[model samples]
Target: MKKILAALVVLVTIGTGSYSYAASAEKAFARVEKSGTIRCGYFTWQPAFMKDPNTGTLSGINYDFMDKVGHFLGLKIEWAEEVGIGSVTEALGAGRIDVMCASMWPDPAKMFHTEYTLPTYFSAVYAIVRGSDKRFDGNLNSINKPEVKVCGIEGDITANASRAAFPQANFVGLPPTADGSQLILSVVSNKCDVMLGDAPLLIDYSKTAPGKIRKVAGVDPVHVFGEHLLVNKGEHHLKMMLDTAITTLVNSGEMDKVLDGYEGVYGAPEKAFKPLR
Candidate 1:
């Protein structure tokens, strides 16, 4: 009886140790600390986010925020693959990256797979059509037709919302290949009849490309949502670290300074971003 009891105790100890090892290994934040790198996943969008294709350099409100975050964690920010809206959930779920560098909005579908740090900003989502195309002039409902080819960034909140708004339209997604500024490119190039994206971004885009695309006057968002960065599921440690960094920036007014600069440069509306509560 003594020998049997001893063996059971040994088994229990081994099991407990194994669980501790597995849990530590599964933690994304611990891995980040060991590696000293945060693999950040991002996609191509411009005005005030991601990289500029012409210069092949990173800039924008998102970039500034990540820079501050990297400074706080003492981790080098390594740009990972440019992930699209369509596959961000899969990429994060597979542990392909440590963090999502670009901002994401809330969606029930996405919430099922991953988790978010606190929201960073609120951007107005809008509908854009080629300036010469009067087909959707001021009529949001008219856009929901089979002939209209609507394109949006795959995995984007706008993509999901656009589908809800224009269910009958032949909506297509810009694959990851078109990840950078391509959704807007599609509308301006006439590859699609409409592009649904951030209002300020599209407005800024219209200025650069001149008379190519224009927002439909008074087109309301399909719904309201806030932009946020993402962390792998149950990565509470990583989530807390990022949330702290962002909240620090907000409290210090540094984030607003960066946003103010971008808003001036990108023509973002005054009400587009508000300080976190």
Candidate 2:
């Protein structure tokens, strides 16, 4: 009887431990379902996700896309916090936000902490330089030298790609909170000789600072990456939920409508490529 009781106790303890593990694994999805809301952490990225400084109004492609997604899923989306590129995954890991509402480049380093949904669209990263600079006009290899200073937002895709491509070059990294203009400023002020950036972002920035920056002539795009929504790692249920919604929206042409509405408001649509089915 004593041995049997000890065995039963061990069984109960093992079962309890397994249940706890399962509960922890599904915590994010369970919380969202219970609340009927998906709290979002977003970063301001022009037409993708923007906040009007004066009015605090939010309007952008992802904003509309996610809104429609919530409607389809019958869940409310709360734009709970504005997160920086460096801290977005940290927020997810800490359960501070349910997901990142804005579309992001799936940087490999972030994969350990976060999971990405199916891509909604794609963009190209280009090497930007001062308009008058022609040192690397056709010779992309020249820019990889150690003397070249490359500027990029810290913890962003630009910085990651730049580091990978130009391993020998000097890197001038801005804080994750720095805006797009700061990247151009790094080049304008000679703080950096080159900066890698998204094509649309650079195009938009060029309008405000004409003749200040241009993509490297004769060199192809440095990299092209898909734009995807993000959730915490191990949250496969939530990721699949988003993936299905996005795929449905994209297939039904709803995603295109959102992109069409933003055309020329910023230098989008022209630079944004639709995702291939």
Candidate 3:
């Protein structure tokens, strides 16, 4: 009788554990459906996600895309919080936000903690240097030397790319909170000799600081990364829903229209590239 009681208790505990695991797996999607709102954690990157300081109005390619996505799903998108690029995964894992509406580069490191929806677009990464500097002009190999100083936002794609491409170069990593301007400043001040970034970001900065920086000419892009919306890992339902909505927008040309509206005004088509159909 004692053995039977112990066996029954063990089975009940195992069953309860399995039930809890299943509940946790669907928790994120269930919460969003129950609330009818998808809370967003966004990072502020120009032309991608931007916040108007005085009015607190949010506008940009990702902002518009997400708005349309919410409409398609019949759900409200709440701009719940602004997250730093480095800690975006942590924010998602903590349940502070339902999804990261901001378009992010899906690198291997980030894949560990997050699941990404279908890519909305692509961006080419370039090596940027001072405008007057010509050491690496035609010789891409010059920048890979140990003496070259590469600066990029800590934990960002550009920094990771640089480290991968130029193993011998010295890496100067800025805080995750550092912005494009800060990275540009690092190059301008000669704190770093080279920096890696997307063309749109470099062009935008060039507008403000003319003749300060220029991309290395006559070389292929360092890398091309697909930009994706991020959700916490294991939120398969949420990811599937988002992927469906994105495919609808892309196929119907609505996504292109959104990108067109921001072109020249916020760097699209020229700086950002649309995904190939």
Candidate 4:
């Protein structure tokens, strides 16, 4: 008799919890529908969400995704350009933005009141070096050798990883907000030995100054990689909406279509570390 009573309690608890969750989700969805506009956060990261110089319009893989998502929900996209990747989290926390799709990594420390959507894209870290610098033997392991000078973005995971990966090498933290082109220029100009960063961005920069920059083979191991989008936490409806939209995009090959549109600018899209759904 007691066993049956306990089972009944468990079933009741589960049913109540599910119904409560559904109620909250419906409420959030109604709120968004009433608003009629979804404020999306944008950063200046090229080929991700950037302003086109020729047309003065915002267009990129991230922008394209948000546009489709907004359309699907019958909401207009309102752009709120942020200065740096860090600002994307800040804006989301302050309730200034409804969704964040700036290629921002979903760091735990920055996730206060923010939720990460499915990882819509991925890229690996590459060791970008000047063509004349042959110290790196095309192997990332060589970067940790003693006397090697390695530069990474300051206050980022790359900088933190540098100490573990290259305890013997001299690790220099470059300012995080510096443009990708400028970062590569610093290395190409001999201001730094090697620039460690996203492989696609480095590959894109190498095209401008041919013969000056070259990428070292082998990507950063899984432990050191990141992929994500940021949205308001507790917004279950919004989260599900995004998840469904991403899954549809991935399945219909629309994700590839959008990414391919910017392939010329950002290089080939890397495989997602996890399922888009």
Candidate 5:
């Protein structure tokens, strides 16, 4: 009995040490501390994120927020435009980027790969139709018919929502290569009849192609979508750090300042961003 107790105690000690090491290894914030930088990922979207047309400097609300986050964390920000909406989830799951502050919603489908921060903004699907295309109005019932070709990026909630909204409508899903801007351009160029996307993205579109295309109706009442930051799921420390950073920004008014700058530059009002409560 004494020998058996000794063996059990030895086993417990070994298990405890192994668990501690594994826990330390899985923590991404600790890894960041070791490396001394936060690897951030952004995407190609105006106002939220954009490569400045003249200076080539990256600018936007997301950029500003991330910069502030880096300062708060006492780490250097090494940012990159990593992937589009379609590929971002995969990039997070695979750990290609430590943090993605881009077009991500609190999509339950992505729960396995990432821990989403509190929402920073709200977006709704809007229908973009040519001013001259009178076939379909903005009404959901009218656009849900079989004849409408609703163009959207593949593998997005927008595409899913389009299908759900208009089961009879011929929903055309483009490859991930086609982003929000491309979807809008498709409609403007007559390649596609209608473009469906988040309101913010569509708002950006209306400005560029003024009077050519209009929001067919109004914002969809479907479950509103939003943008949230994502970190790998197992990285509890990283998640906590990011969450703290996000909360800090949202609280400090520094986030508001950055957002105001972007809003002014992009001609969007401060009300455009939906605070994550």
Candidate 6:
């Protein structure tokens, strides 16, 4: 009888927890719909997404895509100023933003802190080096040697991934915000030997400068992952809405227009973000 009672208690406890989560999710769902504005936190990254530093402009596939989501939801996308990737979890928890539209990768460490929508995109990490510095080219083993000075921005996901993957090499960390400008500058100016970052951004950077920085060709990504929009934890309804909106865009072919130059992974479109036809 005691064992049966204990089992009943366990079931009841689990039921209560689930109910609490559902309640919180409903609050979040109603909150966004009531406010009529989804405040999206974002940072200025590169290639696929960024807030232009010079003009303070938010222009990228992320912005363009999320704008459509807001429209469909009968809400306006209120752009919230977010400076660094490291502080995104804090921003969402502190109620600074309703969602994170920055090209944020759902790192394992952060998974417990926030809810993530299905990935809107996928990108590969590459080694950024000077065009003339062909030392590591086609040689995966070369970058792991101690002589190679690989750098990543402090608190950035790449920092942890690169450090873990290349323990043999000297991995350095620049201050926050270096992921955009300073990381590349360090590689180009010889302040660092190499940078492990997104391949598309590095390729575009190399093109702009012609030879200042180039991707180490033929090196498969040390890390490849999907990017997702994030919201506060327990906001299950909010996440579902976001997931549906993303799939809707993909199914209707409007996502192709926004993701024109970016790479991503899309699931089968089930629910439409709007009318399919």
What TM-score goes with each of the models? 0.80, 0.86, 0.87, 0.75, 0.79, 0.81
Write model 3 residue lDDT over 1-277, tens digit each, in one string: 2343234334544866653423556566768867888999988777787888899999888999998998887788999998888788889999999999988886778888899999887777788999998889877788988899998777667678778889899999988877677888899999999987777677677788888999998888887788889899988667867887899998898888888897776456433455453
Candidate 4 regions exceeding 4 Å error are 1-31, 53-55, 106-108, 111-113, 161-164, 218-226, 263-266, 272-277
lDDT tens per residue, model 5, 131-236: 7776655465777777778876676665766777678888888786456677777787777787665545656766766677766654454445666788877665
lDDT of 2 by residue, 200-253 (tens): 677677778788899899988887778889999888667767887888998898
> Candidate 5: worst 10 consecutive residues by lDDT?
1-10
In terms of lDDT, the poorest run of 10 residues in model 3 is 1-10
Q: Candidate 6 residues 35-151, lDDT tens each?
A: 767888888666556666688777777888888887766577888767577777788777878888876765766777888898676666677788889888897678888888888
Show model 3 residue runs off by greater than 4 Å.
Answer: 1-24, 270-277
**Global lDDT for candidate 4?**
0.64
Q: RMSD, each candidate, Å? A: 8.1, 8.0, 8.2, 7.5, 7.9, 8.7
The backbone clash count of each candidate, in order, is: 4, 0, 0, 0, 0, 1
Question: Model 6 scores what on Cα lDDT?
Answer: 0.70
If both were scored by TM-score, which would come out higher, candidate 4 or candidate 5? 5
For residues 182-242, what per-residue lDDT tens digits would candidate 1 score against the true structure? 7777877778888777666766676667787777876566555677898877765567667
Candidate 6 local Cα displacement, residue 182, angstroms: 1.9
Task: Report lDDT (CA) for all predictions.
Answer: 0.72, 0.80, 0.80, 0.64, 0.66, 0.70
* lDDT for position 261 in model 1: 72
Candidate 3 colliding pairs: none
Reference-based lDDT, residue 32, model 5:
69
